[model samples]
Target: MATATYPPPPPFYRLYKDYNENPKSIPEHPPPIEGTYMCFSGNYTTDDVLPSLEEQGVRQLYPKEPNVDFKKELGSLNRELQLHILELADVLVERPSQYARRVEDISLVFKNLHHLLNSLRPHQARATLIHVLELQTQRRKQAVDDIKSGEKSCRNFSWSLSEP
Candidate 1:
C-alpha cells in the first residue's frame, strides 16, 4: 500500500503558492495556527477566548449526551408532531387558507425531531455493534458444541469397529 504524506499540509497551504514554488524564501516565523488570537480579532469563535456559550434551541449531540433520555424525548416529539399534524388537518378543512401557522409549527416539530434522531446515531451504532458481537459469540459456542458432538460419535464408531 502506498504511504500517505505524514502530517499533510494545512488546508491553507495553497494560499502560500509563492513560498511553495520557491522553497528558500520562507518567512521569518511560521504562520500562526488558524484560530489564534491575532490581529485584534480576539479569537472570535474559539471557546477559550469567549465566555461560556449559551446557545439556544435544538442541537444534536455525539455518543449521546449525559442525563438526556433519548427515547423519552423522541417519544415526546413524536407525539407533538402528531398533534401538530392533526391541528393542521383541522385548519385545512375548516379554513383552507388559514393553515400557515399550523404548517410552520409542523415544520418546526419535524426539524426538532430530526435533530433528536441525529443525536441518537452514535448510540444506535454502539447498540448495533453490541448486538453483532453477541450473535458472533453465540455462533462460536454452537460451533464448539457441534464439534464436541461429532467427536463423541467418531469415538463411538471406532470402539464398535474395534470390538467386532
Candidate 2:
C-alpha cells in the first residue's frame, strides 16, 4: 500500500490548541475571548474584529441539561466538536478571510461541551465522597473486629490462669 501524506494545520488553531488540555488557559476577564495581541498570533487584525458573544447573540439552548442520556449527548457533542474543528481548520486553509462563521460554530460547540462537562461535576464529586466514606466505614469495621478478638484472648487467658 502507498503511504499518504497530510499537510500541517492552519495557524489559526494556535488560539485554542491548549484549551482541551488546559482549559484554565482561556482568558477570564473577557467574556467573548477578546484580547490585546498581535494580528497573526490568533487575535484579530485591525481591519477584522472578532465577534463578541453579545454580537453573536448567544442564548441558552436549555436552562438545564435535558432528560436525555448524558453520555450519549456528550458523545454527540464530542463528535460535533471534532467536525467543527476540522471545518474551521479547512476553511482557514482555503479561504482564510471567511473564517468568522466557522469560528462561531467551533465556539458554540466548545460552549456546549463545557456545559455538559459541568453538569457532570456534581455527580463526580458525590461519587468520590461516597467512595471515601465507604472505605472509612470498612476500616472502622475491621478495627472493631480486631478489638473484639483481643478482648476474647484476654478473657481466655484470665480464665485459664484462674482455673486451679
Candidate 3:
C-alpha cells in the first residue's frame, strides 16, 4: 500500500483577524447560541435534567389512585402492628433481658411502617402522627412502670422519640 500524506491544516487567524480582513464577514450582532454555556458546563433545566414523577411512570400517592381505600389499608396496617406488638410482648415475656435489643428492632419496623403510611396517603399522614403519639405514650408508660418496679434505672432508660 502506498503511503498517504494529509494536506496542510487550515490556518487559525489571530483575534478578530477575519473580522479586520472583511468587516461584513462577521455580522454586527450574531444570534445568541441558546444554552451553549449551560451545555458546556453540564447545567440543564429541571425538565432536561430530571424527568417528572408522572413522566417516570410514578403514580402520585393521592389523586392518581382514585380507587384506593385509605381506611381499609390503614385498618390492615393497624392489625399487622397489633400482631407484631403482641409477638414482641410474647418475646419480652419469654426473655425479660432482651428488652433493650428487641425494642430497637420494633422501633425500626414502626419507622418504616410510618413512612409507608405517609407515602400512600399524604392527607392521612395524621394517622402516622397519631400512631407515633400512641407509641410514645406506651413507651413512656412502660418506662415509668419499669422505674417504679426498680427493674430498670430511670437514668439509663433513654428513649429516642421521633415526631412524624
- Give lDDT per model, in order: 0.73, 0.75, 0.61
Clash-forming residue pairs, model 1? none
Q: After superposition, how far is residue 66 of candidate 3 from its true place, in Å?
A: 9.9
Candidate 2 clashing pairs?
none
What is residue 125's positional error in candidate 3, in angstroms?
A: 10
Scored by lDDT, the top model is: 2
- For residues 1-164, what per-residue lDDT tens digits would candidate 1 score against the true structure? 98888878898666567885787655467865565465576545333331111243534322245577778888887888899899999999999898999998887777777766775677788999999999999999999999999999999999999994
What ranking of all candidate models by TM-score puts the best one first?
Answer: 1, 2, 3
**TM-score, structure 3 vs. true:** 0.28
Q: Could you give candidate 3's per-residue lDDT for residues 15-102 as a string of tens digits? A: 3567867887753566756553576668655332333346644433323354657566556656756776887798788987767756
Predicted candidate 3, C-alpha RMSD:
25.2
Which candidate comes out best when scored by TM-score?
A: 1
Q: Which of 2 and 3 is the better model by TM-score?
A: 2
Q: Using Cα atoms with residue i matched to residue i, what is each candidate's TM-score against the true structure?
A: 0.58, 0.51, 0.28
Output the lDDT of residue 45, model 3: 50
Q: In candidate 2, which residue ranges exceed 4 Å CA deviation?
A: 1-65, 149-164
Prediction-by-prediction clash tally: 0, 0, 0
| lDDT of each residue in 1-164, candidate 2, tens digit only | 96559877887667777999999876556555444556556765334433433355764333343475777777887888898889989998999999999888878878766766776777888999999999999999999999999999999999999999
